[model samples]
Target: MAKGKHNPERKAVRHGTEKGSVTLGGRRVAVEKIRVRSVDGVEIPLETYQALQDPELLTRAALERMIHGLSTRNYAYGLEPVGDDVESFGTSNSTVSRRFIAVRQLKST
Candidate 1:
């Protein structure tokens, strides 16, 4: 730790696995492959999991999640977005900050 440098506190990410299925319009499609792991307690498709590995997809998901969390009262409180999260989502600090501002504006509206 640096004498004067500060590592901002951040929210903890809980990862777990659950068994489930992928549904389309509330119906499961047998043609597509599905896999289940404890993630948010929902069944996701294999493609969905693969897409999560894609940087572009992750950035989009991060932006969406940031907006949703930032605008929600329960999530807005004690929401500390660290650089690591931003970096892991394949986006920059400036972009994340911009998204935060957008969320704030939306919430204020």
Candidate 2:
């Protein structure tokens, strides 16, 4: 059998944000990024940070990423799913709303 390949020396990522950044459009932004440690134990922050001022816009963008990921089967959902896969994660409106709130809380925390 063919064994799955993995990165044995891959470093873990640490999430953090740097606030009070100014954009080219004269808008303030809070940067979000992940840090990785090298041999010297020096944390190198990834070059990732964008100015997203609108909360609803950020929420929509995140949801879009999730939906796109599902469509692309990015979560190891395989090229496709079994018959009942989609139905399995189904939730009611209130449940979904609560989950959305929880996700927002995650950003705040």
lDDT of 1: 0.41
lDDT per residue as tens, model 2, 1-109: 3376655665654445543332211112333334466545777644533333434443443345455653222322322333432222212334334545767788899
> What's the true lDDT of residue 30 in model 1?
25
Q: State the RMSD for candidate 2.
A: 15.3
How well does candidate 2 match the true structure in TM-score terms?
Answer: 0.25
Q: What is each predicted model's overall lDDT from 0 to 1?
A: 0.41, 0.41
Best by TM-score: 2
Query: What lDDT does candidate 1 reach at residue 34?
Result: 42
How far residue 9's Cα lies from its native spot in candidate 1, in Å, is 53
How close to the true structure is residue 68 of candidate 2, measured as C-alpha lDDT?
62
lDDT of 1 by residue, 1-109 (tens): 6776654652232344544432222112223234454434554445674533343433344456555654322332323444332222223445545555665677799
